[model samples]
Target chain A: MNWTIFHQQVFPIRHKLYRFALRITGSIHEAEDVVQEVLEKVWKTPADQSATIRNWEAWCMTLTRNRSLDKTRDRAQRRTAPIGQEAEYQTDGADPARQIEVQDLTGQVRRFMEDLPEKQRMVMHLRDIEELSYEEIAQVLDISLDQVKVNLHRARKAIRMQLQRVFAAEPVQTRNS
Target chain B: MKEQANIQALLDRYWEGETTLDEERQLKAFFSAGNIPEAYQAFAPYFQALQAEHAVQLPGNRQAVRMHRPLRWFRLAAAAVIAILLTAGVFWWTGGPAQQEQQALAPVMPPKIETPQPALTPSLEPAANPVAESQVPKKQTRKGTLRKTRSVAPEPAPEDTYEDPEAALAEIKAALALVSSKINRSKHTLEKGLQEVNHVDILHKKKKETDG
Candidate 1:
């Protein structure tokens, strides 16, 4: 890969790649390694292969996802890792009571997003957080557009349900007060 | 009030994943503006989380990205170590064997006649004694015979005939200083190479100039 192409096209979007990778891998160091590996892989792509890449950002994102998933799978195979370990974004205070006392509602929502199924989590992250278009999301994930929509819809519905459950008691407490 | 109603409608669509990016942005803006109405306060955290996620950048700076090329500094330091090893090897290879041979032969040879004077002599003195002067021709003849014999064997090594410990220490210090200077130069070159790699702004330079 051309250094010029890397610094211009791939370097600027590192944070997006990192967040996507972090969302998948759940470890900051692993995510960074995944991004680095992705960048190096992109950098080493032969000129002909690189020229075929119409969207460097999407290609980089795809690479990031694959690398992150591979790292995650390796981690799982090694340690029989729990899926819930991806809750890196969980609030520092683990207790729900402490969370409520701090009103760390956003942290709770982040944890809910973390608990989402892989497909749904990826789609929601690409759409809501990174703000990629539905087509770009599909392209990065190598999934059908319809699949992206379904996953995104399910992900959003799930998060909303969790949010409501957490806050459903809030109004009652307010009214009684 | 109309804006609040619009936001509420947008929130409903947002939860259903039907809101366009623009509409979602509108909801995000409204929530981030603070002072949410009591009705929509339950959903504020969701939008806040989205906003916070957007703001989360890759930690550190460009250097951290380069650090992904694991152990770049290690490679450079390793090269420096190899270079030092090579220099010391050359120093020993050029000087070691002959000196060892000379040390081995010291007991067999006459110290007074055959021992070579050190190059770094403490003082310039002439061989003025009559007895030594008389032996000069014989010394030359003996040296010539020794040279003929020595030619068939391996060349004798140069001697470190420094009689003063202070002078030897000074020489050692000088050699050490040279090695350290070379290592420092290599370090500077490595740093310069790192700086060169950081010229990642090549693509942005022109745009920045135009903007400036």
Candidate 2:
């Protein structure tokens, strides 16, 4: 998109892209890079300047997802690399006040999802946060529908266990005690 | 010994990657909609995410995406090109006038001197130098007369009213020497140009004679 339109229409979605990416990747810097890289890839080469993309969100997510996976692969390859080293974007600030913590179970669940495996985190995000389907996830991921199910189920089990632990640890208030 | 007691275990096995595709699809549908039993409610977002992922359509643009690159690049390129073109065009336009002036002036310079060379009888007129006299055509004589008649002031001084007429006369002598050097250079250039032009003319005439 042009700068004006990007500012007017698409820039508003940047935080959304950032948030969604952070939800999946669990690192603010990586998520920012994912969003930046996706945007760059979309607009880099003049050749094939336009594509037949019917959903910008889906297209962007697919690109971001693929890039994040690549980064994870590269990081895995370089086992000596530090986390978020030389990463461009840093949403987290020096002050603890900058940390966004919604005082609710959803926020708690999100934080819990952060502890999940990379693939599981993405699966959880794709299934829960983005509200995508097994078929769509498979398409976006270039995997089979059954693989999506396995991943999603595993992700759910982990999240479910974690949330249960978190809720149990917190003093619960019954509505009709 | 029916399997009702192991149903929970069977369901856990389904979630733990042992389920067949049909079984998974059943679970997907079962968890996708409606009350989504509290046990499954926590997993609902994942289910919704799958649907979102699937819905990832093409660049969902109806009125076509706007491009800013070419316009940005072109505006800059066009401005630069126009500036370069304008400067070049000015040079070209002004350059034509100088070429036309040279074309008009070059032909007239050599011919007037050579054609009138035979008309000077400077020895008969009591001139000092015979060789200079011979070279002095009527045009050269007239040019000398014109130079002398136009200004009788100390020649270089522009106004002969110099307190020391000797210094003024000396200045006039220096000016004459400079003018003579310039005239000699011009005469040499004219002669060379004539030689070249005559050579070309000869070749052209021969070609025409043969062709004719």
Candidate 3:
């Protein structure tokens, strides 16, 4: 991992690392900081040792996760407001009503994710959003293959149930109208 | 109707968390394609949101941003400082070259007998003449006995010369305590680094809140 190799092999995964950090930290600014810190740590690894790493992506992701979790833990200690309370993205150039609807939906999804247990949320983010393989997710999260499957299953099931409840309520509102 | 039935079955498996990656992709594609049947329209947003979230990338050239990161030199300096401290701590813990040399030389040194009286009495008892014991040169007899003992004794075990087991134990405990205290201090330094990294964000957020 000279600068060239770092740029090509390691740095390219910055978005994935950023997304994972963002998902864990639940604040874009904090997430960026986490990614920066992770990258710096990775950069500091001796070039020879880093070159021998079999899975650079997994290594970077694991570092990102540890750093993000540290920040989350600190935030917890400080007794701050729960993260991900605000929407993560802003809609642009859309009809005002449609934008509001999209934002609302995004908020609901974010809340659902934030409400999940830590492992489940992390596993879900890696699987669905980052599209990491089960093995990769396990490596990144430092858990067994079976634990990864179990967490992913629980997370998806929870999200499905919440979606069902929301959809179920929507029709009731329509019926009253 | 057949496609709808296929999706329904897939959705069931999806909810069960049994879908393969390709199957999940098919589900995402179906929901994201728009014009979903009214029955499934409510579920479309979940998939849409997944897509939208995936697209939320950092807003600048990552390489450039990283290169120009704030406190870049300071971070490097901090890392260098930590590396030096860790190396120094490890060297100090292992007691540097003097202790290492002492350990290396310990096995080569001769063993000592603290009480020779009892040791010589048993060997002397096996002698033929107790009356001639006084005539015998004690130094020669002791030297001969020591030779016999050395020849009969098994190889000396390394690190067996603790004068006081309890004191040795206390020394080990103290060394461990020192190592642990060093580790705790390092942990605090890392936590402080994390806090410093986050400080800028906190400041920006406060500024935004005040302006708003």
lDDT measured at residue A156 in model 1 versus the true structure, 0 to 100: 89
Candidate 1 vs candidate 2: which has greater DockQ?
1
Residue lDDT tens for model 1, B1-212: 99878887887788788888888888878876767888887777677677667755566633266523323544565566567656665655445767657655644554433434323232423464566556655765677456544532233443644679999799779877976777676666556655554453343444433432
Give the DockQ (C-alpha) for candidate 2: 0.05
Q: Write the per-residue lDDT of candidate 1 for residues A69-147, one digit (tens) a residue.
A: 9999899889955444333443334566644532454456667988999999999999988989999999999999999
Tens-place lDDT per residue, model 3, B87-191, is 766766666888666655643444433234335465665277666566455654566456444432222332454579898698779868988987887667666
For model 3, residues A57-130, the per-residue Cα lDDT tens digits are 89999998999999999998998744453554543325766555656666778778878999999999998887
TM-score, candidate 1, chain B alone: 0.39
Candidate maximizing TM-score: 1
In order, how many clashes per candidate? 1, 28, 0
Interface DockQ per candidate: 0.34, 0.05, 0.14
**TM, every model:** 0.59, 0.42, 0.58
Of 1 and 2, the candidate ranking higher by lDDT: 1
Task: Provide the DockQ value for model 1.
Answer: 0.34
Candidate 1 segments exceeding 4 Å error? A80-103, A170-177, B61-63, B67-212
Q: Which stretches of candidate 2 lie over 4 Å from their true place?
A: A1-17, A45-56, A80-108, A172-177, B1-68, B81-212
| TM (chain A), candidate 1 | 0.82
Give the TM-score comparing model 3 with the true structure, all chains together.
0.58
Each model's chain A TM-score: 0.82, 0.66, 0.85
| CAPRI-style grade of the A/B interface in model 2 | incorrect
